[model samples]
Target: MSDASVFIAGPASWNQIVLLDRLPDPVPHMQFAEESWETLGGTSAGKALSLRGLGRTLLLYAAAGDDDAGRQVRAALETADVPVHWARSAETERHLNLMTRRGARVSLYLSSPAAQSDRDDAALQAAMKASEVIVLDLAAEPQRLLPLATATGRSIWVDVHDYDGTAEFHRPFLAAADVVFCNADRLDDPLAFLHGCIAAGASLAVCTLGAEGAVAVDAHGVEHRVAAVPVEVVDANGAGDAFFAGVLDARLAGHPVPESLAAGAWAASAVLRSRHLHPLLDPHLG
Candidate 1:
């Protein structure tokens, strides 16, 4: 047991990223690309990696395949000194992400993940019980931990990712989180959605608006706003996760909500300036 303070649970994907001028239309027989790369990507991985980079003790509980991709995922985390307890499945979650210069992305799943039986595992249960913070992502496997998370009285962070506020799968997660992070891509009124989160039980609610900035409502119903930090965006894949990690780290350090939001903006800009999920996460490990 590493006694890590933060616990993250969800999918960890092995992705092939192809940089193109733009995403191809629905019509077939189209091809255009500038470059490509392979990397580890998923909401859980992104958040965990960024938090670790911010100098936090991170413990990740996730599932991956027994294949080479899974090996890569495990090695990357281990090399970064982040302890991970991974359930070995038949195949890892794999994706082919087609991205553009403007950060537009179309991800195609190459292989679907197999069902994993780690929710009831002893090691994962121990980690869950010991961690100071539990971050649950939108995945079927992690839903079982919601009840356990509720029992902890520790902070529970959940990212609803571009929810339209009506998905049945997201309701349990929304209710389980002490803090909720979301993006404004799908909702016409993000502020209303954030307010709804607070009403639903979360003490804090944050909404990230791509290039514009981010806004948050604290437990006292005070709205905090911060503009996005300017950076030359290389890839938009992990910016949201970076933002979430930053705000979480700041809050954990007892920073004010406005200062925490500013920290988030700063972290997100660092991701935008680099091509990887966390710029130093990969090469530093290598």
Candidate 2:
């Protein structure tokens, strides 16, 4: 796998995650005790950092404002020895995530700095072509990379988090990915959607079932299931992305889907025990 490198294209944001006892109701004048901190968040940021913790050869490409938050992101990834290809913007994006200790979350997307889609950049083009795997998330900048990644003949992995199936913006990403992942929280019938992804030309499709675990369908149309590894939940902030990174790392190492799913489960368990993005990856990961 020497020639195989991963390229992640999407959004990276500075997030203030507030952990509460429980998600508050929509009533007037209610308060809950909360613990909060700033961390890196965003589909692209989470996946990229998680992948780095797994010791993959990766280049992360994403848009962020030229601000302190963006600097923090670069410093964190650099300290981990992961290279970044930052797309510049006027301001950085920010998210206010209200999470429950039980792992429930209500994310408020507070800011998005304007970014120009720089698909024509020479370095970006070279990275995409050299990558063995390309991970795309549902951000405008990343979406613009779909066609380019497809042209590279690299394995395209796209995470359509909370896709309800009928979202117009999700269809193109769905059609472009060779491997697909989603969560069961938004879909009325997640299993059906997973099946639909395979039918729509994906070689494999997966749906994370939260506490219920995860499921996948391979290219042969054989379905596989893996239960979540049980662990005392500390913070569930980046668990799903950790799961994806683990599976991706395993798959790149030539593990079968079932084994990869188990690896994903193990990786997710470690993330559940951490307070931030993927601080507890297994030593065996490298």
Candidate 3:
């Protein structure tokens, strides 16, 4: 295997959440308590940070509004040492995100028409051409990125966080992916979905089963199952991103499939034991 440098393109957003021991029957409103907010907690930045900690070079490409959220996101990525190679800064597009706690998520996506019009396709293609792998989150327009995938011939990876039940919207990108990652619960039968993705030309398919474990189907159609490392649970928000980062890193380092799965599981376990997805506490990154 060759060392892989990834370019991630998608929305960068802030995540704010409030934790509760149990869901209120009437959805009680609290004046204030302990709340946590991440300046940059979207999938793209999270994956980039996880990969960076594993010593992989990353080139982040995305559009951000020239506002506070964008500034804060850029500062956070800079602190995490992720390279920003093809970012388009615009006064129009605001950062978008979802807030979640204990498996319940609510999205606050920006659907401004001007945002779509501001995308710089040429710059995105330039960055894709320079990368060994390109990973995109479903938050962006898949149609806009598909041509780049075809033009570069670089490995493409897509993380499906939202499913609309329409095959047309997803099939094109799925067919372009070298690897496709999705939460197990997102599919009715993960094994079946893996098969479909494989038939669509995905070289690798991963379905994360939360605390249970994760399954991966490789290029040759071999299925591998790896259990999550046992750990005291804390937060689950970034577990999937960490696992994906691990798989990408291990593969880039030329590790075998079994070892790669183990590393991915270990990375997720580290996230499970932490309050946040920040990699400073993860021993696996070293």
Question: In TM-score terms, which candidate is top?
Answer: 1
Can you write out model 1's per-residue Cα lDDT over 135-236, one digit (the tens) per residue?
Answer: 999887778778767776778899998899798999899988899999887888998888888888889999998888999988877788999998887888
- The estimated TM-scores of all candidates read 0.94, 0.93, 0.82
Model 3 stretches with alpha carbons more than 4 Å out: 1-4, 23-34, 86-104, 110-120, 162-168, 280-286
List, in order, the clash count of every candidate structure.
0, 0, 0
Off by over 4 Å in 1: 118-120, 282-286
What order do you get sorting by lDDT, best first? 1, 2, 3
Please tell me which model should have the higher lDDT, number 1 or number 3. Answer: 1
True-structure Cα RMSD, model 1: 1.8
Q: lDDT per prediction?
A: 0.84, 0.81, 0.68
Residue range 120-170, candidate 2, lDDT tens digits:
566666788888899988887777777778888888999998898899999
lDDT of 3 by residue, 152-231 (tens): 98888888754433556676677678888887655678888887788878888888887678888888889999988887
How big is the positional error of residue 183 in model 3, measured in Å on the Cα after superposition?
0.8
| Cα error of candidate 1 at position 255, Å | 0.3
Q: Which ten residues in a row have the lowest lDDT in candidate 3?
A: 91-100
Model 3 whole-model lDDT (C-alpha atoms)? 0.68
Model 2 TM-score is 0.93
